[model samples]
Target: MKAPLLLHVFPGFAVGGAQVRFAMLANRMGPRWRHAIVSLNGRMECAERLAADVSWERVPFAAEGSLPQRLQRTRALLRTVRPDLLLTSNWGSIEWAMANAAPGGVPHIHMEDGFGPDEARGQKARRVWTRRLVLRRAETVLPSATLLEASRHLWRLPEARTHLIPNGLDLARFAPGGQGGDGLPVIGTVAALRAEKNIGRLLRACALLAGEGLGFRLLIVGEGEERAGLEALAGELGLAGRTRFAGHMPDPAAAYREMDVFALSSDTEQMPFSVMEAMASGLPVASTSVGDVRRMLPPEQERFLAPCDDVALAGALRPLLCDAALRRELGAANRLVAERDLDQDRMFSAHASLIERLLMSRAALAA
Candidate 1:
């Protein structure tokens, strides 16, 4: 009885939500399943975050000359690995679906977590056609109901083949009761410094609160291309001393512990792990009503405001920061929600069970 092989393909294996989820699944699956991670861009820092025993490989995508050359390289890799199941995520690896299907058609699973700024609002026709063509043979996995519907109606995927598996939080690592440091109120957000995250909005909101004579510090964690621009914006808004861009912290849980209130000002998101981690750390969140965030949060802590509205965000932030008792109450409520629904072990079990079921059904069909 040979152990099952699961190969996961992604744009990069960096410290992102998808990578974290994959690491959790691979580590917990243990010896029963062999896991290999393929990062198209050769960024495997997140692989280091995985458990020591877990095995993985990094394949850099060389987009040098022609489309055929790229396709050839992808096919060669698929042939060499010959994985039992192929799991590719996002737009960057959609082409791998075509490569997997080209040669003997492996049991490919395409997981659509969300999209970037280009297709943030909805799926474009070109992308939809490409997905329908490339992903026709694979089963689709969507992490949010919003994405599930997009796959069905927008990408025209069959309802039978689509599975909705929400992202889960690690309760132990992100548990509540961590103490805040001695300082003015701290409002923090943990996300990649990408345009979609809209850290500028958070900065503006902080400036508004500060201008109103509130004593608080703003901490923006994580890093990306927008670092310099955001720093300049903070300075321009007269928040040079008050706002801190912490870059990429290895342990964001520690940062979450220091914050009086957590905030996410992303223009687009689908079940952001940062928010879940914040909730698990017992921090009340104020975020834009994007994706399934409203559904994921408790009613009291849902505080979903319009994205980029500094006034509305400022209004929301004042109560959470000034009212100590309110913050504690909301924090307690959030932690309870996380403990009840977002435990990492339960998430790992659910994913493993789903994979097993898929494998069994495929085997039965082959028989």
Candidate 2:
């Protein structure tokens, strides 16, 4: 018998957290599973990370239509591929949820990473109902406990069908104890400067830190549509000399070590990989209390968690950035939390187990 086929649908396959997670799971699971990826907008930048031994197919979803027509198109493809399982991600691919409900559609698992800029405040009534209705039959997976709650209470998803699978990192690869910068303390963050990421607020917060006359360099890693706006904001805030915008780099592990402190200023996130990577790099973190971040960090570090604004985030950053001893102490504690709880082996195994269960049920029904 051939290995079971799992079809993955993503908004785009750039080197984002979701795409990276798919590659990690596929690479580790190896030949035991055959995979197919459908990027709605067709950016396959992360495909290069997949191991050669994995059996896979990559086809950009090259079609345009209204939402209902898109569902019909995806439904037709579902019949053609005849996959054992269909894994759809984020709000962008909710059409697959509709597709899987069609006759002869595959069993599906819909993964909700987080919301786009539009739904930043809360889910709009239309999309909320679409998710509630379309995702009724599928197992909805969320990495954030916060999202998990939202799914159950707000979206009215069945508690039994909702799954919380925290995004995990390859712990050994991002291990701590590397050389760090000594010249000036570095306040760094690795995020595309998107509207939802709220990098502008972070820059303003950096300016706040500077107003207090702290010695630091704000290293803003990654690039996106909001980059120009952020650069101009930095100049306006007099952070032009202090902030360094390093356009997207493939590897962030080395850069984590170069930071005296790590930051996350996002308006929303569901277990961001950068935070885990920072914790694994043994760097103290100062972040807004978004998603499961408050629970994600060590108990003592919770005080540094703030609301989503420049002043609030700056207030959180001040204490950690000001005291070198506190930074060292918190960094050690964060690394221990990563080692104790956030290992990728656990995440990989959890996903493999879920996938295998889905495949086995499909096999049983066929038998």
TM-score of each: 0.93, 0.95
Candidates in order have lDDT scores of: 0.81, 0.87
Candidate whose lDDT is highest: 2
Query: What's the CA error at residue 164 for candidate 1, in Å?
Result: 1.1
Q: Which stretches of candidate 2 lie over 4 Å from their true place?
A: none
How many Å off is the CA of 50 in candidate 1?
A: 0.8
Residue range 104-175, candidate 2, lDDT tens digits = 568889999898889877889998898889887888988888899989988999888898899999888787
Give lDDT tens digits, candidate 1, residues 5-97.
Answer: 788888877788888888778878667777777787777767766777775555456745676787788888777777778888888887788
TM-score of 2: 0.95
